[model samples]
Target: MSRFTRTQKILMCLIGFFLALGLLFQGMRQASIGDIGYSVLSYLKYGLIDYPLTSIKNFASDFSNLWKVQEENDYLKEQLSMTENYQALYENAQREKRELQELLNMNESLSDFNIISATVIGRDVSYWNDQITLNVGSNDGIQEDMIVVNSQGVVGKVHKVQDSTCIVKLLTCEDKSNKVAVRINFQNEDTGEDAQSEETDSASRAESVEGILESYDADEGAYVVSLLDEQEVEEGMRVVTSGKGGVYPSGLFVGTVKKVESLENQLGQVIYVEPLSNFQYFDYVSVIEVN
Candidate 1:
């Protein structure tokens, strides 16, 4: 009923033929054309609308997982910091325990003597005249002339005392008044034995070779023993306080003989002694109150 060119009419007929063929094929397969159209519409709706909604849900789930992971990382860092702090505290406690044990052992060794424990506070700046300051003073029963000793050996004598602190004149003091009566402990010459002999026999037969500690030589780093008895003194001999003058207690360790020299005209032997007390290292000492 419409006016059209011949070519246009021919194209319209061809389209109608293909559409009829598609409907006929669908009917043979027992599927209606309307059902086919509805299936196509559902596929398009899923691609445009449902698929985007599913993608958004997946994105939200990924974001939540990422946030949880970050929180866990932060928590682990905090725990690591706490662990390091605890480790440092544990090490410090162990060091303190060792120091206390050493102090206790030293106290036990001096159980027979009346002692007042004190800590070294400082040292004299002069190298020639060695001295140390103690934290105890007259308030702690400390007084001048009190003998100061440690686990190793005698340290010095209290020189001056204050209300809370005191100064000790070390055996190395370069003063003649600081002399101490010392004796060399030698093995029994009659038995012809060495230092490995029995304790009782050695003690009974031991001869005390007397000497006077005069002064320290800063250049030689040793104490000079003057007025030594005319005895057979040797190197490596143990020296101790003889308690002759009543200033220092008997049997307090002094040092060991490093060398012995003959005096001119055979007056006496000059013995050089290395002190047992290590002035550079000792931190705690006991002031003996001889009863």
Candidate 2:
């Protein structure tokens, strides 16, 4: 045989090299496929060619899932917070509604009176007396000396008024003075020159028949009824507004009498009064607005 040419020899060597590499790669692929692996070995064979691309793809998918989960969590948390806030607001509104309804019921019970419901805005008992402030003012048609009443009884008169606030004097306050009539029904002793006990019924009747004089002194009685001279009031009787001055309306309930003093020249009487307004525990009140 003639000596092989240089080009031919080069071609032959290249073909042999390719043949060996093909066999080696095929054998390796068969061995990898035979091994038991879920996705690792298969990815290594196919994914190694563009390793960075495959890795980026996997990283992106994982990042997307994590982002979706975070967004869902944030939304759920926001919803829970809003739910709590709405529940609290609802409860507060219900409480306010109940209070308003009760106040309205009190307004309907008054006889012969026009009611103007107002809220208590400010209160100070410092200077004049136990005086409170109301939200009604001149613009709301509130005037001076208007009678204010609560569920229990009377509050006081309007002392001062601004555009949106008014000062109300309390009944038992130091500065405020009220005059009322009262009555007391108590059992004590009878006044007497002619007073007869139950035991001396027949004797007393026989004496009276003889004209021995049955003179009973009103002053000698243990309990007596008299006018409250200082307060211009009477004991053991209903104390109402005599309507002496134009200040208060007539027949408004002022208070009830507790006691009276007996005196000679004047109607001797002292009165213990229970104010109609329970100021100690009053929350709502009404002002009479006569049109």
Candidate 3:
């Protein structure tokens, strides 16, 4: 027989490859042939590559939102701080306005003297209640013995005067030289039944009585005024400067009678007068230079 050729051998191998391809397609047809390849490729892409990338993107977005929330909180805190500062400024302005109005009224009543307005610049820490320093001095016509006052009542007198500052010795000092001649005006209305035991049975109806404020009673927070003579005095009596020695002016309100005590060894009664001015609230004052 003729020897088998290379061309026939190649033909037989190709036919065998076709037969295997045909059998694989026949098996796929039974299980949705057209979609199986696509489904496998899609599952591998989404499950391994696409799903992981999507999770990473979502995590980054969540981080960004958290950072934004923190930024918003910081911004709110800054706004609140500014609001508090503005409120403090407004309150200070209102306080200054009220003080100015009160000073205006006081100016009208004390028109007789050369009024020099001043601000409290310094304090005597060693003797806080006894002394304070003012912003006015010799240049401002503030001299020694010049009366110092606020809207409420007498503050003190200029003790030492400098070129632009003066030290005021307060009337509330314990010194014996703090004496002021005072006149007491008894009230016509009843001052309730809780009056001190030293009050007389009869409502004191002397048009007015006179006393000398000699010292300060720290325990009672009152001024101790000694009567010139044994005179009937009661609670609710208005006390004012008598202008006798001319240190303090006439009709300057000093205080009101808080209590009265009769001295057994002395001939006069000790009157306790509550000061008209709040000693704790001193900011501005006026120096009275007798024109």
Provide TM-scores for the models. Answer: 0.60, 0.44, 0.76
Estimate the lDDT of model 3: 0.83
Residue-wise C-alpha lDDT for candidate 1, range 82-109, written one tens digit per residue: 8999999998777556645665676677
Task: Give the alpha carbon lDDT tens digit for every residue of 1-291 in model 3.
Answer: 757688988898999999999988888786685588789999999999999999999999999999999999999999899899989999887876777678768878999888999988888677877889899889888889988887777877889999999999887888888788989876655466755443574445366887899988878888999887556898888988888857888887888899999879857678999886556566788888865
Q: Cα RMSDs of all predictions?
A: 9.0, 14.5, 7.6
Q: At residue 104, what lDDT does model 1 achieve?
A: 65
Angstrom error at residue 205, model 2: 24
What local lDDT does model 3 show for residue 24?
A: 88
Per-residue lDDT for 241 in model 3? 87
Alpha carbon deviation, residue 240, candidate 2 (Å): 3.5
Q: Rank the candidates by TM-score, best first.
A: 3, 1, 2
lDDT (Cα, 0-100) at 187 in candidate 3? 65
